[model samples]
Target chain A: MEISTTKQFDLHRRMVRIRLFEEAAGRLAEANRLPGFLHLYVGEEAVASGVCGALNDDDHITSTHRGHGHLVAKGGDFNRMMAELMGKATGYCKGKGGSMHISDTSLGMLGANGIVGAGSPIAVGAAFANRYRGRGQVAVAFFGDGSTNIGAFHEAANMACALHLPIVFACENNEYGEFTPRHKTMAITDIVDRAAGYGMPGVIVDGMDVIAVHEAAVEAVERARQGGGPSLIEAKTYRYYNHHGIQNLGLKYRPDEEVATWKQRDPIFTFEDRMIENGVATREKVDEIWAELRQDIETAIQFADDSPYPTPDQIMVDVYTKSSTTIGTKS
Target chain B: MTRTASIVGMIVNPNAGKDIRRLVTPATHTSDVTKVGIVRRAIVAAFESGASKVLLMPDNHRLAERASDRIKGDIEVLDMPLSGSRFDTIAAAHVFCQAQVGAVIALGGDGTSRDVAIGWPDAPLIAISTGTNNVFPSAIDGTSAGAAAAFVASGAVCLSVVARRSKKVVVKIDDRDKSLDDLALVDLAFINSMFVGARAVRDPHTVHAVISCVATPASTGLSSIAGRIHPVGRWETGGVFVRLGAGGRKVRVPLAPGSFTTMEIAEVRRLGEGEKISLSGKTVLAFDGERDLPVSAFGTVTAHIEATGPLLIDVEQTLVLAAQALMFDETARHISEGNHVY
Candidate 1:
């Protein structure tokens, strides 16, 4: 697939946004400013930017624990997301759902699941809804390589195929599932092979290359939308940060050399070089986008800092529908 | 030899229930999570009622499409382009009309149903309320609504016998000699506000509501205001017109969930069918509690009651008709013969 300049620029812009947001989140978490656990999507930016770029705004996506990249790629507002991470009342879910559970249903973002493989079933249900309604829209499930071992993922994959649900199960194989590496948990090297067991097409893509991932996703998404069954895409990528916000713990698990090697093939820098080489954008224009993204992230952080926390009295509210008289009442 | 198959059109608005009310008032958020479950139940019920095929309106969130995953029936999504606007609903309705669907089941609030009505004025509709201000749509169980829709679709119950043409308030621009093709099925409120701020009738005092259909006391929004003053049954021939302010008798009404406000009724009158009432001023006219069109200063806009809205299926009545017709006798007998009867 030929990558147009507009598409390349957009992909770069989205990757920059996710990277900047993740970096800012890392800084905040390190300083103990954020209220909850932060999973930075630093090195795995290309997978989100590429896959989301291939989807329409109406298409649904169920994200994993490391979901900020997915949400941002899907056009989520940085201000509300930052506010949510800070547990502010103005955030998504009214601060009731923090970073791990942030969702903007208007954008077709199902929600960021905190539990491993939890989003798979939700994605299946979303795909099912799409099929039942006869809406030719596809649902994507973005889970980590570790989530492949979870039963929900297998069940969801099986159900999606049996029902011929229009869904794409995109696994970000970032080498490590929390502290343990991929080899330690799974026997197979490529997780996409498991799609065969579910009677669906499985393909592998270079997750570090945004163009490759986007091409793969476009094909998978189109197939599903056209009534073709689900497809599993295994994107080979690596994470620069540790499992959580704590960078120290990450260093203890992965060696410095492996991290350095992955950084050398960093998605952002490689994409920037490709853009310049392909005459898509100048180095200065790419630098400008990076600078603009930094400023945007700063504004979002400031907005989150200024936003107030949820009132103590609001704790019981939003638990259920207000139309129901039985809910939230002391009977 | 083949039998004629029944097809039901399903439209689920993902943007439904996520309005400014959640942020402005104490109303709880009705996310896509709840809508997915409702759509699932509706689809299953439609299949159970012998619907051979279902046409789902494609939406941004894929609410209906996702719900179709588990259903084993032939489901076709309307192949119309979507702009992620209300026009999508209108386009989908047009497709359903062209396809000559047995009935259309709309999962949304008043706005969604109104859009469907605009496309096919006489099409049979089963409106399930899923939005903030839900006066037009009924809060019936999804499964029952689906079953009723299927009954009509399958010709198990005739549409004319179990359905009624809804009442609507037609708006006409007097100076421009133009009339809005869209009709408000429940209440049309002429607000004193200059602009359509937030697209909701937030301040109840600024509303001068003219309802074409019945407004029950149990309903909410501007319809509730009319319902409080004079309760009109659904089968009533006329409507109620109320001028709201702080000068008349104070009546408490719920504008949104968990949010109630007291408003005064300056004038209340009965508006008979085909009766025209004119309003001249710079105001935002809200249809079914959703502020849509704006009239300039000194502009005259007339609202007339019309009994030509879409045919709405009464779920209970349709189910009763199905039972009376022994629609499920064959399946019951089959199960009994197989020794699986409960």
Candidate 2:
């Protein structure tokens, strides 16, 4: 997938943005500054960056619990994202949704769901709508390997294939399902095999390399957008932190050696090194990018801290209660 | 366990058949599932032939990990991080060389074998065909190839007599970095292009020249452009050199799957061992059908054939030698009274 130098720069920049954002959020969570659980996308940044790099600015995507990287790569505002994490009124959902539910309609990012496989149907539905409107917009559903076993995922695959919907099922196979190893819950080693039952073409790519992921995604996205029906892409990746937060719980779910091995293949650093070798950018440029993103995240944290909380009158503004009295509404 | 020759090294390329060529040509796409199945059969057969442990290259699809499921023997993955490029294969072969593995099984195309050769030139390789326009790999089944590999790895079948040491064409680019030095097992072609985009040489019109290590008659790909005119075999001491242009003899070559392109041949001849062929042009250097290093018009590249390559295992020959030694004889098995040496 012949990516120009400009696109290569964009890919690496987006990856660093995600890594920096996740690192800041992790620090906040560790310091007890954040309210809700933050599912950090630390080691799996390449999957989001590469998949989104192949997407158009107006293309739609449904994100999973570890969706911060997806939104950030899709051009989500840092200030609004940090505010949403702090539950401030200036957030993306006006403080109603935290990290897991953050979404920007302008960026065509559907809400990141807390449910494991719920994004599948939403992405499929969005693809159907896009096809109906004939705007040439493709929808990508980003989920984990564990979700491939879910009934919703299967149903979505079946419907997308049967209807020839313009959707791509992007599976970030991080080798675990929350606290459990994926092997314990699933029989198949490759999640791409699940797409075969629905007669959808499946592709497996290296999630640690942004170029590999972007190459595969470019083909799959093109295939879907050209009315070639849906395609499933499984990226073999790993998450650095525990599924929820940076603070390690007492429970040992995986081994240190495994974590150490994965850390050596850190997507952001590797891409920077690669870009330098390929003559795409200089080391100073890479360093500047990291510094800029770090400052941006810090500013975003301050913004979230300074923003006001939702007022009492706004408590029941977007929430539907269907009760006789409008709850939380002051006279 | 004491026979340091009990380990078999495996390199299964996940991206071999999955390339842009599939869209351009009617190439057979070898799904990761089918590759896993082939790996399973190969590893099991290696163990059955008395190999104690097997080491596999870790890939993105977890082909090694998946192939090792429920496998009784010690199926170890090389302790190395992946770069997700051709470097992964080279790194894995380097590890295998440091470990001094008995025999290595490569599951990919000519390009995959070439990568392994770069890491360990003296590797006892059993390269199985799993890519487009393959000439270095064999068409044998994984089971037989694995069994033969086990025989070689176990020192049961001697390499000196049964194995065929293949030939390779090494190219050194002057005015370029030392890393640009590369080799090809079958053929090295000069593609008339500036960038190595997509990696596959699809258009016959762009191929300017080819230098082949071993071009068997009736072969396909770049070698066939010369093979159809003058044949060369693995045991031969020399190579085939050809230049492509108009107003010359035209021959058909299957550059990809399900189709053929007739290429005009300007000149063809036998390239003797160590005979350096000079190439100076603005073109992409394609090693075994994969466009790798590019050359500028100011740089001069020299390519020559060498017998210093991998020791390719002869599956049928190794099995025949084993049968001759009563290793597969039922009478000998009965005489052993179920106290199997394996």
Candidate 3:
């Protein structure tokens, strides 16, 4: 599929937004400003940007723990997301659900699940809803390669195939599941092959290349929406930061050379180069977009900082429907 | 080679009737079995009324699938790949809008219809009451509701002729400058509490009801309080605002099924459409019987009624028109003449 200049520009802009958001999050974590675990999606920006760019506003998506990039790519309000990270009352969950649990149902973002492989079933449900309603909307589940081993992922895949649900299980093989490398954790080298077991098509794409991921996603999403059951997409990518915090935690496991090699293929720089080479965007224009995104990220951080924390009384609210007085009951 | 077919969408919320009210009040539980049966009847009725396709929203319990299993029409059970939640309803609404479905028959109460409205604000809806607090949807037979929906969906009865744009309570947080913060189909209550625990307004003393459209005295829940005092008609252009507190006229109100509470009404007044009522205090604002927003003592929340809600399909009116126009008779005659129809 040939991508238009406008679409290419949009892909580039989305990637830049994710990168800037992740970098800002890393800085805040380093400065001890953000609470809870901060899993940065630094180098994995292409997968989210490309996949989400191919989706309509009505298409639902479920994200992983390191989901800021996915949320940003799906047009989530950065101000509300940043406030969520700060545990403010103005957050998506009204401060009850922090970074790992942020959800904006209005935007078709099911949520950012803290548990491994939790979002797969959620995405399947969304896809089922789409097909059941005959709306032809697709749901995409964005997870790490580590999540592939979880039972929920396999169960969801099998169920999706059996029901011919319109869903895409996009696995971001960032090469690591927290501290353990992908090779150490799983026997299978390519997660996409697993789709064959569930009787669905599978594709592997260069996670560092926005164009490749976008093209593959467009095909997969279109096919799913057109009644073609589910598909598994393995995005071969790497994460720049440590699994959890800004601290590298000694970087004792992986070879230093591997990190250097992956950095050389940084998705943002590669995509920017492609944009300029294709004459889709000028270096000046890309730079301007990056600069503007940086300003936006700064504003978001300020908003989060200025936002108030939820009051004690709010802790009991939103636990269920808005009115039951069931909170604080030991039973 | 080509045929135009009307599609009617059905959304069933299995979680609607299974609320805290089941444990607290004498409200009857609507089992998954009954919901499935209702959906099946609705689908069959829609097909009989010339709906060529029936689209059902998938649920966790396989409600829609089971309902459509024995049916042989163009029934498509939506693919919900994940576990069922309220979001599924909203997502299905978006799909129905995209598919240009003739009309939607929502099988739940106010909350279920609200979810559909959120997804497709102007969708033509046949809201059926199957939940505890049901003020928006009426207690109508599924078969009749489906037939009416089919008439609207298939263009046998014009939408304008059979439906009217219902009223909605548009809520604004703080200033009335921002976009509509939230909305409620029947009632918006400001409760003198901070937490939204259990989600239902159990205690009558905690509520200050602001209702749009009509609240029948025969109905139950918070809307009944307003209906009992100052009954507002469905087409009335304004709303009723009632303050509940001490040292006021006492009135017996049924807060839930088999649960009647005497509420002290401090004040009750009629507010015209577009007239803003500012609520400021340490409270939580409950919409459509569920508490959702928490307002600080200094915070101000504004609410006003507007004719911007979903176009509710009058089932009786639609069926009546279909009869008067000989739609049912035409189908019967066609069948008697051995004229095959899909």
Candidate 4:
């Protein structure tokens, strides 16, 4: 009820942008423009868009390998992202850090980590720094259900709770940590239950509904900023695409019927339908938004294609500690 | 007549008991070794090795005194009077210099070793792993460590050969009363999102670093930025510092954090000496891999990378020699002949 019409509409637009971005990335991969493997954030856009919307620019966030939506929702630039995927000099890491390692610290989006459950400790450490400095900063770490099974997660949670660090653990329970379903890997169905072990609040939200996720995130972010320590929020969501490439080819672990059932809850379509029914937006307005996003993506692609490759000499940089006096010289 | 050697300095950490494997006691198998045993062994080893003077870096428990009384060698074990944090190994290094110890041996994991190294770059150090993660310390027996110290004391191996020094960065925050341990070699940030604590453990937000020159293996901290960049150091030396401010905007880069999300970098600048990089707020500075002091607001932290001087012993080399002696060697014969086997 606290959400205004404009905020809800903005969330809807962000969710669509994430979906379209992944869809386009998948197509670009097929065209052989994007090198390396790509993980699409097709179904879990709501979780990223909603949770990220709850944070301010100064708030920090750590992401997983499937972090495009998280990055975009956190306000990452599309042109730079496309340039990076193309491995152009203009890319974020100057074409050095590809998909898995992409980070924009400016946006409070800590770089997405490749290791499963590896980003948790770094987040905890950041939260500890924030608390120690007495800064009103909060840290958010986004991972999947697969990561919850990691021991590092448990240790970090216990430590964060014990130390009263301001952090929010957003677990996107996509039911699969790769090919294996949650039931196969974990005993409990609800990942939020993991929070009880840390002696903190655990929340479960309908991740398909962006509003639900937003409300949950707002509550968690406020609590953390106010020095209420940490909380665990499990957003039940799913991935429409395969773990990486385009081949779903009949999920051996999950029945075909289940996939069909979850697709019915596709966040984009649900939000669109709700917007039209509630008189919040017309089909034309939604179409306009999509068109704008598509055009933006096209511009991004063009920018990346036109951007020159980094100078060959530029190859030997961004790795070690560079001194101010030693600029232009190879370390 | 054999002249007894005097122990110049002893840098003892009380936490070495946290990670010792005891096969003799089945009940306490794989548990933390008793702190008293560690202290006792360290002090006794120092005494027997001709340590006539000692400087102890004990925890708040005053564990150094208990170890001093148990030693048979006539040695002066003076406790390092420390203020501020007990784990502030940097402060303790100043104490070692004041004590005028010829060599300083530290007992801790990579972070602890890095801490001591940052504090006393020129002081000789012996690293012992007592922490969970260890990449720098030599996983050797305490007796071997003691023997190695004695060798350094006896002029068996040159001091320059025993401690190898790497390049270090010194951050002097404008008007601040402290120094930083490790500046972020890549990127540092303050994260605000929430996930499970462990799963979110990724790299540090590196604000200022001498990235164009240093390199290391897969570290969870700043050095991993070098790993992300094409292996430059193993092939050649290179580094860069990317400033990531508080914006989620993507600066797309080719390097991936691990195997997942693609990263967007902000701005990449070539660092040089005497370059003035001003930070907005007083940010906390971490070094090598451990968190250090914070930079206060209105405080300016100048990061400059310079070659550090320390003759460090290679664990691989020492292990090779130890293996030769234990299996079959002239050194082993001499040790046995001298009745040095304990």
Candidate 5:
């Protein structure tokens, strides 16, 4: 999975965009400007950036509550997302879906679901659709390690295997599923082990390393698109912020030392250093990208501010496809 | 107006709504999975909306018996020949079709609806949510669901105008052998792209389905994936394999066991009114959720989509209209005369 110049640069830009977007959104959420529950994807940027980078526009991806990173990584407009978080009229869901439920079907990014392990079966269904039509498209479902234990996850995995649907079940094992340590909550250490029961390949990747994740995801996506069966990839990543709101320190859960230990392998710094070490990019270029991201974040903020609030009538819309305007856009 | 009136029959799956057993004996309730409560509510609502008679699908499950007891008006309990198996639901549906019921009101998830639909094609169908994976059932309340059914039964709701007709895929195995009713309604799944199976439950094998409408135009199920990429499903009706978990170099399709996790499809074909699906493999064919006959490796199957169908009425609307009619303080003729009201 050697990175081509175009792919590498695209990954770099997307990683930066996700990080910056979260940082901006985190600030607004802290200031109480943004409404509802906000789960920042500050540290897990590489995972989404890398995995989504391998997907084609026709490929499908389902997201979790902490889905802003996936949304940005999959080419969703930052302005509309920001507007949605701000409850503006121009948001992807017309302000109905905020931080947790952002969606853009045109981008093959299904809305982030609030339920755990909910997207797994849906992605399988989407993959089934692709295979049935003889299309080379694939579907990906991104969820947390905590979701592995849910019946939905097991059911979906088994179905995926039995059906041989083209799908990649990407589990971002962020250690804590809302304060509970991964070890204490479950008997299985590796979420990938669950994949064995379903009789599929389950690969573990360093979620902190963007290149590693990209390589692994690329294979899975290609296999899916080429009529191969589904695969489950468990990306071991860490979240910098608390489960919700501003980053809560410990909050009576994880130890300070454990947090510090994981922080030592910060994905962002590692990527930046790797870029320089490989002579692919310089510190100057990195700084320039950061500057550009800052400008983009500012523009998104303006868009959200200028965006209108959805009229009350809009609320009556979008609940069903009979009323949805985007129904006919699918191929 | 009398010519427009359609006689719609209603049936309920006893394993719908919240899992009440989860509160106490999590094992018992969660084990078999029942939608009886949802079925009961939908039936009651339908009866309240002037449904002359409703059919309650029988099962050994206490939920079905209890639900059957709850309906308001005169009701008929159709005893399914299958002792206590899940096939009882399908048998009950067949009975309703044999009764020449103009339409079918199905209460359950996609599986239940699929079962009833296969048994009674072009029969007006009103599906209400009561099962776990509910893509076909309407989320509307039981009262509304029953009302909609009543209106359809009484010839108030128009099929071509209000109800959207769904396409069914006809599948055949070999040159001449077994067959499938509608292969695309989550009926057939190709596991790991190798083995063919049924159902959409948990498994490692990939799923393959042949669909009539895939391009976001039909039901959002396993077939939607193919619709997005190839869009071939929109042009024709057939099965496509949606692969799931990774497997050998071969194109493996994941399928459910008996019904929930895998399906093996020997042949793929289109479905219409006159077309039939044939299977050639020694594989078993499960229609909807009920187990059907087995097809040998050389069996054949065929399917054809029936365009002209009965008008499906919404139970909800039917219930609402019935309530309104009751409030009119007059007879049926009086309500009919009041139709001129602005």
Candidate 6:
């Protein structure tokens, strides 16, 4: 009941950064200024912002293909991320990894994955490493609804719960897997139900409500840090754009009314209203925050645009490591 | 070119039974799977009993939405942003009120009902027991509940005749000119606590006073603390006030689900109709078994008894009224003899 304005403002800042940064990427992609297909994190910004807010700087996380939000929330530098997405040398992976393979080892962000369910196992591995180090840190696996049906998710969940690992499996059930509806792909509506099969506590939260997701993540993170074993969190969310691009592909698979219904509960907009009502921020402050983020995102884009691309002669260099440059510093 | 038919509003609280009480007490977790089955049965019965449309409250778990697949009638999920709290319940009830719904069936415990009452105090409500606290709702099967709901909804049984007017405790808290008014269908406790954490009032030691709309020993909860000594009926004119502390008659009261504590009652008094009482508090107010709001230090918190609760549908009574009112005739007799009515 005691609403913390500071915590709320921090959460708002993180979400706005992701939204503005992704919107910038979207604008570039729409104008053909950016290359490659992007799985944008447009609607489901609350999941990343909420989960990463509850985590420590050293706490690890493995993100899915739609992962710009995760990286930005986890203290990722926007200039480096935009540069990487733009395939510049100043990018996170020196431009080779591009959008999907961005990672920050020092910040404990494992990587934004290209594969559907690949992050689960990596998060499990990170948790195992954290356990081996005897550190009280936790690792989170961020995946989508369709990813839960994969063999990797079940195997990782079983292993984590069995080993009492400090990990949280955060499922962003956005009702779609690429083009197909989730109901057509899976029988169970709630992906968290599978957590019980793996002998872990499953929590379902409204991913549109950042506070709900944040509270759930905080509880799960605390439980994992206290050696209470892994827990699964399923966030009921939605993606505003198409699965692969920013363009309107005119997909007939989704109902028009459902889209309108979800847009009514736009996380950022509703959260702004909630913040104002709860005395966390004023309308003026909300406007100021958005303006600031827009400016920040523009600067990052400029930084990426001015940077150099990967040179042809240096293709063999930094591709492999030890056979490579040292990790977590400029290559 | 179309006739407007009656609509039944169904509010299924997915977060109801699953709370911190599951950790503190051996409270039964109402799984989403169970909720789905209940909603399916309820929707089926409501349709079978002549309800035309049903509007479901949106939740993280698609209990009603999933159940809609099997329902062979008009169904729509209310278009609103879900906050995943009691605010969702209140908002849905408010929508249902504006729409002038024929009936509203809410699935949760007393807190769920309290939320609905706050939104629309006179809503024709059928509260089914699904969560931890058990004051407002009853253990009615989904089939019977759905049928009864439709009976009221479709004018097969009139709400004014079948549904009873329940008493409620009105709470008004004024702090720095911002006034918030809330209602409890059962008991409102002034708890000696700091914050409203976990929502449920589990610790009996932290409780100081209770004002009840219906106090019966059979109705298990904080109300029973007053109920065991001085009983009050659901259709009663007024409420009961009980001061909690030591040095009085100790009664074993069921506080939370699967947990009961011996509460020593210091004083008990009967409140008259529209009788207002002041609770001087730097305390947390637990309404209908959940810690709702915190009273600031030396804030003005006053409560009064009113007959402004929901139009509670007595499920069996509705069915019995239906049977006596010519429903147990040739159609029913034919169905009873294992033949189709139509």
lDDT of 3 by residue, B142-207 (tens): 899989888788777788887999888888776333334778888888886534534667767677
Q: Write the residue-wise lDDT of candidate 4 on B185-300 in tens digits.
A: 22233231121111112223333332333434443234444335422242222334545544534422312122222344445555444343545444445444333444445555
Q: What DockQ results do all the predictions give, each relative to the true complex?
A: 0.02, 0.08, 0.01, 0.01, 0.01, 0.08
Instruction: State model 3's lDDT.
Output: 0.81
User: What value does the lDDT take at residue A117 in candidate 4?
Assistant: 91
lDDT of 2 by residue, B154-209 (tens): 77777667777899998888754433587899999998764454567767888999
After superposition, the stretches of candidate 3 with alpha carbons farther than 4 Å from their true spots are: A1-331, B1-4, B80-83, B175-180, B330-342
Q: Which stretches of candidate 5 lie over 4 Å from their true place?
A: A248-250, A323-331, B1-342
Model 2 - which docking category? incorrect
Best by lDDT: 2
Candidate 4 lDDT by residue in tens digits, A116-140: 8987887898898878887688999
lDDT of 2 at B323: 77
Q: Backbone clashes per model, in order?
A: 19, 0, 29, 117, 149, 1
TM-score of each: 0.51, 0.77, 0.50, 0.48, 0.49, 0.72
- The C-alpha local distance difference test score for the whole of candidate 1 amounts to 0.80
Residue-level lDDT of model 3, residues A25-133, one tens digit each, is 8888788888898888889988999999999999999998988888889998888988988888888887778778888888789999999999999999999888889
Task: Report residue A240 deviation for candidate 1 (angstroms).
Answer: 30
Where is the poorest 10-residue window by lDDT in model 6 chain A? A318-327
lDDT of 6: 0.83
Worst 10 residues of 3 chain B by lDDT: B333-342
Order the candidates by DockQ, highest first. Answer: 2, 6, 1, 3, 4, 5
For model 5 the local lDDT of residue B3 reads: 34
